[model samples]
Target: MTSAKALLLLLILVNQQLLTADAELISLTTGAIGAGAVGAFSAIFGTYSYIKCKFNECCDDNWIPGNVAHKLQQEVDEKLYGQHIAQETVIRAVRAHVSKLKPSKALVMSFHGWTGSGKNFVAKMIAKSVFKKEMLSKYVHLFVATLHFPHPEEVEKYKEQLRSWIHGNLTLCDRSLFIFDEMDKMPYQLSIFLFLSNGGMNAIVEKTLENYHSGQSREAITYKEMEQLIKNSAFNEGEGGLKTSRLISRHLIDYFVPFLPLERRHVIMCFKDYLRSRGFPTNADEIEELASQLHFFPKSSPIYSVSGCKQVEQKVDFLYSDYVHEHYKKHFIDDL
Candidate 1:
């Protein structure tokens, strides 16, 4: 037991302690690396799952899609000129329905009015404003009754097909909009038609031979019949009632908006709007002069446009062209 022996023992203990420390450090470093590897693997797997779900049917493209209420309000306020009440009602109804937690029913609106009134225009506006891609959305369906159901004998078949179409679309997406135009011309049975009124190449037109007395009639359903038909199609509770149309009963009719005939003032406003959209000057004098040229019913009838701006754009085009020609004559050509 000398000093040298004691020193050697101390050195051995020191070396053993250093070895233990190195082993502990290595263990800690390995644990950290293992945890980092697990995290990396988890991140890669999560990203792949996300991409797959996005590409597949797991994610709906239009789930809680656009701010429909705001867009509708904006569209109506900006685009629709002389229908304040109609515009307001459309915005309110659309916003309310879209705001619901789970809207069990579709908003059914009936637009009725004279031929050239803004019924179809407003209907299309509603559809476009509600969806992100507007009318192009897969959920929006436009059906013109006169275009869809020409043959009266095929009414029942149209009914079944309509029902199936509605069911199928709703199944795919509950937020679908089915817009039926030309309700005034619809058959009493609430079915479908082929639109022959367009005068297009594909449209069906009635012609009478001088030798033959037989021809297709263009008789429209009376207003009373139209009312009954609408009630039967939209409000009936079940398919078993006296009113057997389940399409309307199954879906809720949110509003029945009637487009009243446009007065001369409304027509003037439409003219101004059209002018502004076309980047033309819409001064009071110009609108009045243009309005005077439009033909109204009852030769003395307060100068109202019965066609409700139907011919305004074309008339404007003609007027503008004349104006341009006159300007050239007054300035460039006359100077020469």
Candidate 2:
């Protein structure tokens, strides 16, 4: 049993003993001392009950036990652009997992995509929907491969520590969300434990282009088509952590959600979205200019964004620094 459970048992036994003693004392001498003893026991038991309730309710502020599916769907639809496959897969998987009274295993999703293709964005959305404090919540843990486990020589040591950290956190809050970014950079050994990025970029792009040329909507792409492609690429190509990892072999990962590369129109949408977020007017000309700054892929076709919307916010801010400052200053002065 856990330390908390042991402490609770101890408290229960002590309270029982105190209750028995108080009853005998009250029966023996109906005096001030007996009445005082009875009052003290009652107070102790009440304190114990309060402590128990607090322990149980400690995670309430961070975790919402309600239907997270609707909230997640709404957030994804509104904020996340492109990658229709990722949007649908995540919602259905999360809904099925969360709605269960007791899941057979933890919900493990491996996100595969090129940089700025909304892997991190979708992950954040999931965290925001499930966690009240989002990324700031204690229960939401994010581990970047390059930062957390950089040294390949220390793989064994990292493995032990990683296991302990995950186990301890789950003990505290089983509903915890763990996001491992840059899985492509992690040592193959560590990928056996957790699953991230750049594992299926080519497949995603090629398939997307194929769909477009076939006159199918981007949303028409199905999870079934992407799943096998992503799994194969993650397992076979590159020196990515997922390559030959037991997590893939044992099939521990629940889903390999693919985030497709963004097109010119999607990049323009991102530009407008960023501008709106900063309280700036989304002028047609300005939006077009901002979108123009980003480099797209396939020099022949030039259809998909090379960096997607990754640098959009920074680029917008850098280009319109003076305007942003003036807008904010005007607002501040008006308020005054």
Candidate 3:
């Protein structure tokens, strides 16, 4: 029998013998036998527990330890494009929070930027760093505002359900991660309950321009400056769910991360990366052609991508579909 089965069987046998000995215990021989049975049972139970925890997701073994900060930094550097400020802020925040033995409260960060500027991408990276199964892990919960709370009128109902869901998940695993996407679409009432959003797009763009015009490098923008701008924007912006929300009023958010608009060069990098990931040719000319297909903003300067890398995968797939079909026909259909 396998070791687990063997151990289980041995445990059952030992329990039965101990019970029988207990019923007639009095003699020294019986006492000695009972003591030995107890010892064996304890050892077998310990061994079984160790095996179960090691091979199963029943314990801390399934969670990534604090050392994952280093891995997260490396992955962000290699994979994530643009948003230098976000890269540094996230790495530092996560490293500091995870390293703490007893954090006073949950680490809450608000990512702000225009659509497709890597807000969700960074969240996924954080999830991957902390959970073995990454975004698919039971500990990771993703709730899209539009999908989960469609009715703004039923804000109270959604709040209760959301609260219960978070509590239930936390009970199951204290390390649970709850990601709320499209926070701008969520009802303002629900803002106080969760921790996520995309706000301050205009302010971010304006600040970036101001810095550039002032002869300052974009990379020199500090977290403090970006944080203040994002906070002000979220507070004053009517469309954002976080406007006047208790989370911001009470200073509950730990960091307000800004994802700068992706420039043409960054979008090109994204195209090449996607192509390489899908086993497609990373030809410089072809990649440039693919990137040129994307729409850039500010008709005058035409610097940043209008859609960022959001549509990159779709564009790449569409570009290759016909080629793939013809290649299949040539290699497989011709042989038939």
Candidate 4:
């Protein structure tokens, strides 16, 4: 019947759509798989033209293409930096962060900053291009930046399992970098993180002494302890979190609360619009001086404004947005 033929055609179309979506998902996760027998299959798909099945060629589609992994490799190889500052900066970062490291052991460098500053995009490009090349791969061990969560309710891990992970890298016996992308969001930057990322053990020195209080815990943390803490504090949901049947809860903010340093407080104010609301300091001070120095911060706006910590805590959207709009307007708006 004509009706039966139409139904069959519709079903076939639906199946093809599902297959396409499945393929996309696999591409997105190719960089996150474990290597084993299954990993062997992944490698074949990623690197080899298995369809050239040697003597065992068959009707099977062994010549299937790889996902984003393949595409990324091609992009890195084909990328031609045409006298752009961003490309130069990326190359500088690669040279400064990787090439300069001592060949004694593997190193890591966490490029911490706000979101949408192209951390992952830039990181992937560097790893795929610099580390995969024959000359650098011979001595400079490179890797994709890894993220670890520390406690419950947070996404990254603590210092618990970090040591063993580093110990595993010991066998490679070459200087390398394990870059951490976001450090300000973490409870505190671990010492080992600096050691692994920076190549030198003492790279964990404070960039600003103002952050440390007189009586803060000064004991150094070990890699194992950090990793163990991460493993213990896992998130668990017990039957839709018990909030007594008819109970209600509301969160409140304290006005003009005094905490943290005066400079830090001002930074938050400038960030949230509170500074503009309070008619931001007309008498120029150190904050303005430093803002100009930091590339991460935007160029001073004629119409400067800010908000409170409560409004934009853990969300550096404005800063990242301002930076992206200035530099990568066309690419920034595209759907990732």
Give me the candidate number with maximum TM-score.
Answer: 3
Clashes of 2: 0
Least lDDT summed over 10 consecutive residues: which range in candidate 4?
252-261
- Per-residue CA lDDT of model 3 for 91-147, tens digit only, reads 998888777766778887778887789988888888888878788877778888889
Task: State candidate 2's TM-score.
Answer: 0.80
Residues 160-182 of candidate 2 have per-residue lDDT tens digits of 89889888887776777888887
Question: Regarding TM-score, does 1 or 4 come out ahead?
Answer: 1
Q: What TM-score against the true fold does each predicted structure earn?
A: 0.58, 0.80, 0.81, 0.26
The alpha-carbon deviation from the true structure for residue 146 of candidate 2, after best TM-score superposition, in angstroms, is 0.4
Per residue, candidate 4 scores C-alpha lDDT tens digits across 1-336 of 333333334434534543334332333233443444355444644443353343332222232111323444454334421112223333443344333324332323333212222344445554444333322333232332243543435423443345556555544322333444322222211111221111111111221121233433322223333222222221111322212211112211001001111123334334434333433333345345434333322134221112212233224444345554655666766744
Better of 1 and 3 by TM-score: 3
C-alpha positional error of residue 4 in candidate 3 after TM-score superposition, expressed in Å: 22
Sort the candidates on TM-score, descending order: 3, 2, 1, 4
What are the lDDT scores of the predictions, listed in order? 0.54, 0.76, 0.76, 0.31
Residue lDDT tens for model 1, 1-336: 433333334434534543333332222233244555455545644674576546443214443256778877877777665554456656776777777766655556555444455766766676666555556666667777668877667877987898798777767666666776543333211111111111110110111111122432222212333333334333332322223334344543455443444557878888888898877898899889988887774354343355767888888989899776777789986688
